[model samples]
Each structure stands twice: as structure tokens, then as C-alpha cells.
Target: MTVEVGSPAPDFTLKNQDGQEISLGDFKGQKAVLLVFYPFAFSGICTGELCSVRDDLSSFQNDDVQVLAISCDPVESIRAWARQEGYEFPLLSDFWPHGAVGESYGVFSSDLGFSFRGTFLIDKDGIVQFLERNGPGDARDQQGWRDALQDLAA
Candidate 1:
């Protein structure tokens, strides 16, 4: 099921690097959510993209918005990666079900055993306001995310 703009986002609870259970509905009525799905942890492209977000965290994560990065890697791997990279935001592990959340968002590659790069911005009301999908090895331009957040604010 491909999640589309203006539709309700699929809700799921996953464990972050710190072993915290975070649910999509947790941000409802408080903050918009930016769900970032990536293939693996500690990879070069994924590191570059996520480090960009980490560097400009205030833009993606503030009172109005929360950024959640998800991957199929095990919790221990993500925990180590987050610590190694000094990532302040949550790095969620979608490992137990092995990409269930990614599959729900239509970004999981079953044959590849991982998720492609996918981004979804869901509003406080649980509606998806923006969506973008990129295949493996394709890097996403975060400017589009900032632009969408600007529109969401306006």
C-alpha cells in the first residue's frame, strides 16, 4: 500500500536506538512527523543524508516537527551508529518484522531485504502532507523537505 499525500499515514510503533518505543500516533495533535526510511546503518550514502539532517536538526526537528529515521537494521546496530555519529534524533529500528513499516509505506524492497530511500511528512492530524521515494543509491534533496515544512507552516 503506497502512502499518498492527503491520505492518513500508516501507524506503527517501533523501537529507537535507545530502546524507546515510539508510535506514529504519539505526535498527533502536537507535532508533524517526518518519517525517513533508509536501507542500512553506517553506509556512506545513508550516513551523508542523515548527517545532513543531524547537522541541521533544528530545521527538521523543533516544536512543530519531529523527524524519525527508520531502517531495517537491528537495534544494536542503530544504537552503535547513532552513538558513533552523535545523532541526537531517534534512529528507529524496523528489524523484528524485518521492514514491516517500510512495506506498509510501500518503500520496502523484499528482494533486497531493505527499504529504499523514502520520506513522508505527516501532519498533526495524521494526514500525509508530503511524500517522496528514491531507489537504492539515489540521494534525496532535503530542500524539498524544507519547502514542504514551510508550506505546512503557511
Candidate 2:
């Protein structure tokens, strides 16, 4: 089962595209977090989804919110993709354990050996505020996330 709304978010530490380690706990008392898990870096659908986030960064990430994109791809791959896409938000590498974190989120596809599309909005208290998951080959509507944030703000 996936992490659900009102449930505590599972804390994790993974390297960012820059090779810097980041943890969910780092934002616990500072800002709510938008955790995005995709299958891979540079894949067509993955690129499109993240590019949208790149283009709408202010709405997706700010003083009140933080965006962390996760993938099973290696740090080197994510670094190249992020640099090419001009993504300002952190793209975290769930590569070491080979999708361990994604599995924790219940988004990992064992047959495909990667994570599907999973998005979670966690409040500053570490409780999940929003949760959505899409299967492989499926795309996501980010507006849902925006709407959720708007609700939080209200």
C-alpha cells in the first residue's frame, strides 16, 4: 500500500543530482515537501513532467514549499538531465539501493525495475497531505498538485 493522506511520510536521505545528500527530515519544521517519483531521467514522459515543474517552479516550490524529484537513475544521469533541463528544484537519486526509496513509497514496479509516477505532498509535520500515483506509461496532471497547495494555503 502507498503512503496515504494523514499518514506520516517515510523519511529518507538520498543524494541530489549535485551529489549532495538531502533528507525529508531536513524540511520537517521548515517547509512542506512535494515529493515526485518518476521512472527514470531523460525518458520522454519523465522529461515532460519535470520540465513542467521547471517552468512553474515558483508555484511548485518556494519558502512555504519544497520540491524534490526522485528517480532510480544514477546521480550522474540525473545531474546531466537536470543541467540540460534547467531544473532548479532538487532531483534526488534513489539509485544506490536501486529503487529502495521508491519501493518504500509503494511506487516501484518490480517487473519494470523502476518507479512509476508517484507524487506526495507532505506537510511540515511529516504527515502526508496529498498522494497520487500513476502507472507506467501514464502521465500526471500537475494542476492537482497546485490545487492541493492552494488548499493548504487557504
Candidate 3:
């Protein structure tokens, strides 16, 4: 039940690793958002995918876009993970409502008590421009995201 393309991106206010509140709607009319929903903070596949985003952050954070990674991990764990990985992007904590944000996006798994690997590229207008979800233990290729961003610019 991942949110479909052309749908309005849901709005949410969640604490980042730094305990700062961030909302999706804050970016509207400013920058497109890359909302990444992952199961955990320090897991293997999750780390790899986010690191790739970290490695190419400029491409994602120029005048038009920004990346925000969300997970069910507590803010403390997220803080440690972000500090360890040198991730400058916001790593939001969905632990208060226990994955409610991911659930709304159709990525949370009640059975597993976590979220699948779901990525949504939302445009400045709050419309979902691209969407992809992978089951547990699966990896994601980030090029598709870049291609979609290119299309958005075109």
C-alpha cells in the first residue's frame, strides 16, 4: 500500500537525530524531498543505501531537493548511528508513535515491528514523483532516484 505516484505526500512532524522537529510540509515550495523509510538505523542494507545518498548529497540537496531518512529507531540510537556514519542529513525518529509515519506511507510492517525499504521522491508541490519498496534484506539501486530527479527537472 505504498503511496502512489501523483498522490499528495503526507505531512508529518518528527524529531530528527538532534531532537529538532522537522516537518514535510516545511519543504513545500522550497525543495523536493527524498523520504527514505528503513527498518533500522544501523543495519547493513540500510546503511549502504543511505551512505550512497550521503556520498552524493550535493546532488540531492542543491537548490531543488533534500533527503530525509526516517526509521523506527529511537532518537538516541539514530543519533549514535548518524554520528558514527557522518550523515549530515536528517535521520528522523518515528519511534514515538512507533512507525506511524511509515505506516501511513504503507511501508511499516506490524508483524516484523519495522518498516520495509521504502523510498519516495516527493516533489516541491508535495506530489510523489517516484516510489519504490523492497522487502527485508533487499538492497536498492539509487540510480533510479537520480533518473527520476532528472525527469523532474526536465
Candidate 4:
């Protein structure tokens, strides 16, 4: 089942593009997390979506919220992708156990061996405050996420 609002998000410790351990709990108390699960790095839609975040960073980067983009790609690929795309946020590698974290949140697309467009807004308390899932190739409605974050920050 997909994660829902008010439900506690599953905690995970994934490696960032730099191969450093980064856990969902790492940002506790300081910032809520915007967990973005994409299909892959360097994909057309994925790049566009992430670039949008990079272009308007103030919407995501602040004291109240931290944005993290995750994919099943290896750390090396993620590192290169981040450099090419100029993604300032952490590009986490859900690689090793192969989409295990994505599976935990019910976002794994087993057929494609990747994640669909699943976005979860996890509050400081570790509960999901907003969640959205779109079909393959479907871009997200980012306004919804921004609105939710605005309410949370208020």
C-alpha cells in the first residue's frame, strides 16, 4: 500500500551521490523532507522536473524543508547526473538492495525495475503530510507540494 498523510514514514539510510550515508532521520528536528522518487537519472522527464527545482530553489531549500531526490541508480551515476544537471540537493542512491526503499514506500515499479513518480512530504515528526503518485511518464503537480509545504511552514 502507498504511504498516506499522518502515517509514519519508513526510515531509511541510503547513500548519497558522494557515497556518504544519509538517513531520513538525519534531518530530524531541523527540517521536513521532500522525498522524490524518480524513474532514473538523466531521463528526459526526470531532468526537467529536477531542473525546475534547481531553477526555483527557494521553493524547496529553506530552514523548514529539505528536498531529496532518490533513484535506484548507483552512486557513480547519480554523482555524474547531479554534476550535469546542477542539482544542488542530495541525489540519493537506492541502488544496492535494488529499490528496497522504494518498495518500502510502495513506489517501486517492479516491471520497470525502477520507481514511478512518487513524492512524499515527510514532516519533522516523521509523519507523511502529503503524498502524490503519478503513472509512468507523468510529471508531477509541483504546486500541490508547494502548497502543502507552505501550510506546514505557516
Candidate 5:
């Protein structure tokens, strides 16, 4: 089952593109987390969606908010993609366990060997405040995310 809003988010530790360990709990009591799970690093829809986030990074990442994008791709692939796209935010790799974190969030597709587009907004208290999932090929509207962040701020 998918993780629901109002439930405690499942904490995880994964390597970022730089190979640095990043844990969900590290942001606890500091900033709200926008956890984004994408299917692949260089795929078209994923790139577009993340490019939008990169373009409006300040809105998604700031003192009170942090965006962490995860994919089942290897850290090397994600590192190249981040470098090529000039993304300032962390692009995490869930490749070692092959979508373990995605599975925990109920977004992983075992048959497809990747995750669908799943976005979760987790507050500093570790409670999920907003959740949205889109199937493969379905583009997400980031306005909803902005609205959720605004609500959290309020």
C-alpha cells in the first residue's frame, strides 16, 4: 500500500550523486522534505519534471524545505545526469538495493524494475503532509507541490 498523508514517513539512508550518505532523518526537526521518486535519471519525462524543479529550486529548496530526488539508477549515472543538468539538489541513488526505498513507499514496480512517479511532502516532525503518485508517462503538475509547501509554511 502507498504511504498515506498523516502517517510517519519511512526513514531511509541512501547515497547521493556525490556518493555522500543522506538520510531522511538528517532533515528531521530542520526542514520539511520533498521526497521525489522518479523512474530513471535521463529519461524524458523525468528530466522535464526535474528540470522544472531545478529551474525553480528556491521554491522547492530553501531554509525550510529540502528536495531529494531518488531513482533506482546507479550513483554514477545519477552523478553524470546531475552534472549534465546542473542540478544543485541531491539526486539520490536507490540502486544498491534496487528500489528498496521506493518499495517502502509503495511506488516501486517490481515488474518494471523501477519506480513510478511518487512525491511525498514530509514535515519536520516526520509526518507526511501530502502525497501524490503518477503512473509512467504521466507528468506531474508542480503547482500542487507548491501549494502543499505553502500550506506547510502557513
Candidate 6:
């Protein structure tokens, strides 16, 4: 039930690791956003996935594109995790509303009480350029994201 490509992305305001509010609309007409919704922080798969992004961020580091990682963890936990993981990108907290943003993207899992692996590439126009979701316990194919970004940057 992820967002369809070419459709308008749903806007939302959520707190980042520093507790500062970040709204999806803030990037409109500025940069394309890579909105990543994961299940938790400090977990093995989650750690590895984010680390990959951290280690090779130049691929998505241009002024025209920004990466935002969102999780159901609280701001405090996300802050600590970001520090520990050396994630220079914004890690948003979807905790207060308990996955409200994830729910809007159709990635929230009520039973697991967290968001699944929903990854979206939103263009500067606030349109969804790419949308895909992996089931719980399934590792995402990072190359797929890179390929999409390549297509967008073309």
C-alpha cells in the first residue's frame, strides 16, 4: 500500500533526533528527499542499512537531494543511536504520534507497533518518484535505491 509513483506525497511534520520539527513540505521546490522508514534503532539490520548510507552518502549528498531516516523510536533514543552510528543525515522520530507518518505512507505495522521497510524518493515538486516496501525481516536491496536516484538525477 505504498505511495504510487507520480502521485503527490503526503506531507507531515515530525521531530528529528534533536527534537526539532521537520516537515516534508519544507523541502518542496528545494531538493528531492529520500524518506526512509525503518522499524527500530540499534537493531542489526537497521544498523547495517543505515551504516551503508552513512559510509557511502556522497551518492545522495548533493544540494539537490537529501536523505531523511524515520523510525518509531523516541527522539532521545534516535539521538543516541544517530550519535553512535555517526549518521550525518536527519533521523526523524515518529514516536509521539506513534507512527502517524508511517501510517500515512502505508508502512506502519499495527501488530509489530513499528514501521516496516518503506523507502520513498520524493522529488522537489513533492511528487513521489519511487515507492517500495519490504516485509518484516526482509533486507532491502540498496542498489534499487541507487538505480532510482541515478534515474532521477539523469
lDDT values, one for every candidate: 0.96, 0.93, 0.91, 0.90, 0.96, 0.92
Residue 153 of model 1, lDDT score: 94
- Give a tens-digit lDDT track for model 2, residues 1-154: 6688999999999999999999999999899999999988989999999999998899999899999999999999999999999999999998878888999999998788899999999998999999999986999999999999998777
lDDT of candidate 6 over 39-132, digit per residue (tens): 9999989999999999999886579899999999999999999999999999999996898899989999878899999999999999999989
Which tens-of-lDDT digit does each residue in 1-154 have in candidate 3? 5589999988999999999999999999999998989889889989998888889898776778889999999999999999999999999999978989999999999888998989999999999999998997889888888898899889
Reference-based TM-score of each model: 0.99, 0.97, 0.96, 0.97, 0.98, 0.97
Worst 10 residues of 3 by lDDT: 56-65
Q: Over the stretch 1-154, how does candidate 1's per-residue lDDT look in tens digits?
A: 6799999999999999999999999999999999999999999999999999999999899999999999999999999999999999999999979999999999998999999999999999999999999998999999999999999999
What residue pairs clash in candidate 2, if any at all?
Answer: none
Q: Indicate the worst ten consecutive residues by lDDT in candidate 1.
A: 1-10
**TM-score of model 2 vs. true structure:** 0.97
Error of 6 at 110 (Å): 1.3
**Candidate 3: global Cα-lDDT?**
0.91
Clashing pairs in 5: none
User: Model 4, range 37-130, lDDT digits (tens) per residue?
Assistant: 9988989999999999999989987878899999999999999999998888999998879999999888897788998889999999899999
What's the CA error at residue 123 for candidate 3, in Å?
Answer: 0.9
lDDT of 4: 0.90
Pairs in clash, predicted candidate 4: none
